[model samples]
Target: MKTLTVPDETPVFPLRWVVATNDEAAPLVIRLMLALVLFPHGAQKLFGWFGGYGFDGTMQYFTETVNLPYLLALSIILIEFLSPFLLVAGLFTRVVGVLISLLFTGIILTAHVAIGFFMNWNGSQPGEGYEYHLLIVAMAVSLLISGGGKLSLDSKLAK
Candidate 1:
C-alpha cells in the first residue's frame, strides 16, 4: 500500500481580517442602535411579538402575497430574526451589514418604491414609503465600512 503525503503549505483563512475592528465609539453606537431598532422587528416576525405575524403568517405573506420564492422568504425571516443577536455581539458585522443592506434594498424595490420617499406617518398613503429602508441601508453601509467598534466581539477578535 502506498502512503499519501500531505502538502506542507496550508491555506490561511482571513478571519481576523473579516472581523477586524477599531476602538472607535461611533461604530459601537451605530451598531447598538441598529441592533436595538431591528430586534423588535425580528421578534415580530419570528415570535409574533410586537404585533408581528410570526413565522407561518409572515411566510404566507411573503410567499402568497409577495410572490417570493420559499427559500428567499425563509432567508429574509431568518435574517431579520437572528441577525440582531449577532449584531449585538458584534460578530460578522460586515457580513450582517451587507445582508441588511441587500434585504432593505430588495424591500424598497419590491414593496416600498411605489409609495415614494416618505413614511406613512399620517396614514395618508396606501402603504409606507422607502425612507425608513433607506435609513437602514445607510446604517448597514456604515457598519460595512467601519466594522463593529469598541467593546465588540469583532474588536477582541481582531486583537
Candidate 2:
C-alpha cells in the first residue's frame, strides 16, 4: 500500500490582510449601523422575531412565491440571519461585507429594480424599491474597503 501525502498550501481562512483594519471611528460606526439595521431583519427571518415569518415560512415563500432555488433561499436566510452577529463582532468584516453586497445586489436585480428607485412611502406603489438595498450595498462596500475599524476584532487580529 502506498501512502499519499497532501500538499501544503496557503490556508484559506484567517488571512491577515483580509481582516486587517484601522483604529478609526468611521468604519466602526458604519459597521455598527449596518449590524443594528440588519439584526432585526435577520432575526425576523430566522426566529420569527419582529413579525417575521421565520425559517419555514420564509423558505416556503421564497421557493413557492418568489421562485427561488432552495439553496439560494437557504443561503439568503442564513446570511441575513447570521451575518449581523459576525458583523457586530467585526470578524471577517470584508468577507461579510462582500456577502452582504452580493446578497443585496441579487435582491435588487431580482425584486426591486422592477418596482423603481423610490420606496413606497405611501401605499401608491405596488411594491418597495431598490433604494434601501442600494444603501446597504454602499455600507457593505465601505466595510470592504475600510475594514471593521476601531475596537474591531479585525484590528486585534491584524496585530
Which candidate achieves the best lDDT against the true structure? Answer: 2
Candidate 1 clashing pairs? none
Task: Report the lDDT tens digits of candidate 2 across residue range 88-139.
Answer: 8898899999999999999999989999999999989999999999999999
Would you list the clashing residue pairs of candidate 2? Answer: none
TM-score of 1: 0.89
Off by over 4 Å in 1: 1-13
Runs with alpha carbons beyond 4 Å of true place in candidate 2: 1-14
Residue 146 local lDDT, model 2: 92
lDDT of 1 by residue, 1-159 (tens): 433333755443356567878899998888888989999988888889999999999999999998999999999988887888888899989889999999999999989999999999999999999999999999999999999988889877665
Give per-residue lDDT, candidate 1, residue 2: 38
